[model samples]
Target: MPDELHRIAAIRDPFEQLRQATARITAAQEEVTELARLRRRVIEGLKDQGLSYADIAQQAGLSRGRIHQIRQQGPRPEGAFFGVGSVTIATPLKREAIRARPVVAVEDVAGAQRLGDLARSLRLEPTFETIPVGGQIDLNRPNLVVICGPRISTAVAETLAQDQRFQFERAEDGPWTLVDRESGQVYRSGQDETAPRNWDVAYLGRLPRPDRNGSVVIFTGIHPQGSLGVVQLLCNNLAEVYSATNGEDFSVLVGTEYDPDSQEPLSVEILTPYHLLGDLS
Candidate 1:
């Protein structure tokens, strides 16, 4: 029995070691809490600067919820505000109209109405044309022409790219940014190099509506190239358009062509009068 006990003594007591490790872990946890407290101050400052939760989380290598929790807490540690993340905001580029001439936009009825509303909203008047072949409108003419189709044909996009009037660059992997001939600024949105599909609303950078003269010209298309969720959220919040409708509109356009034969009736209840008059005034 004594020899057996001596053999067992050779092995260390793992349970005792585990207790020490646990105590060390508790100390480390306390240190982590201290660090988190310190981080809270800097996070509060960032929140005040319009930095989003996701942006802050990415920079901090922590979860957004954790940063939000830190922000929700009132007070922070003394040295917490020292380390901060980058503070850069993406400012959207603006372009001016090239020529004060009649503009043409190719789109469906719903798109037409929305574009019309946008024109009325901006006070910029332009011609809406359906025929693509007529030389009545010069394709090469440097005017504020807002294209509101579901999707622009690849052929047209290629042609537009060849035109020297607009400096076109494939902005990111999807959207093409086009700078108007008159305005050096660039406007960005995704372009579908395929068939025309669903209609959506957008502000053509160049066209300043006459009524809303000198203001941005917003137009609608059957299908627009962008993250639907972002656009839908904007519509829901600003236009008072329901998210479900936006979702339905987006889903119908996904992986298929949108039917232009029928126009969806927009509920007047969804329309929110956004006054850009103050800006123009």
Candidate 2:
């Protein structure tokens, strides 16, 4: 309300006042809509926990019929796993060995497109941006999905370092890999070994933003194929993923087995369970 419009009587221009009023009303309506969706989501959770409509109504002081109606209205709660309203998907621009200029990879574009389509299907607006050569993006923004690996983004690397469950590290001469800090298990892309295969592993997680006001979804892999596989996995199993993570700050490792010729994923698996980091600072 910092820029909220004052009384029309105090305004000298009625024309500008009308525009201000309209904008304020629209913003209020949007806030109301999101609040209603959140309430509905809570009711749905109560029901999911084996509570009857009557029980939920009693706890909330609403009628059973109204509770049931609320359950059917608004967007699905799982959709919040991505974002509310609009979402921004950021891919990285990398300097390949042969290319003189850094460029967005074809595989990254494909992955971003799939993620954008997923956002659209959930009734949310989707926008795409390519992280510039340095991979320095605004991490304070809300509803952001970053698909750049740590090797590519210092900002993203700092954010990932806060999550203690999994460590993304690379040796002096080896490929970038993921390590289980607790068990000392290491995950590496199949294409990196001396005898390469058609599979890759990736990291998927909702980590706290730099400001700690909210969270950002981070998905990255050792290679472009690995990130693409994360999208393919989410496109099919977002619900299960949502259920496990439940809108919390968490990280998980995923593996994508792909065809060698086309680099298309043949199968996707959750390499580790959701590692919650809600207590992290």
Q: How many backbone clashes can be found in candidate 2? A: 0
- Residues 94-206 of candidate 2: C-alpha lDDT, one tens digit per residue: 88778568888888999999989898776577999989988789989889999987888999999999988798888567678899898889998898877888889999989
The list of candidate 1 runs beyond 4 A from truth reads 1-107, 133-137, 146-155, 160-281
Measured by lDDT, the strongest candidate is: 2
What local lDDT does model 1 show for residue 182? 43
Report the alpha-carbon TM-score of model 2 versus the true structure: 0.85
After superposition, candidate 2 runs with Cα above 4 Å error: 1-22, 52-73
Q: Provide the global lDDT of candidate 2 against the true structure.
A: 0.85
**Deviation (Å) of 7 in candidate 1:** 99
Candidate 1 lDDT (Cα, 0 to 1) = 0.36
Highest TM-score against the true fold, candidate: 2
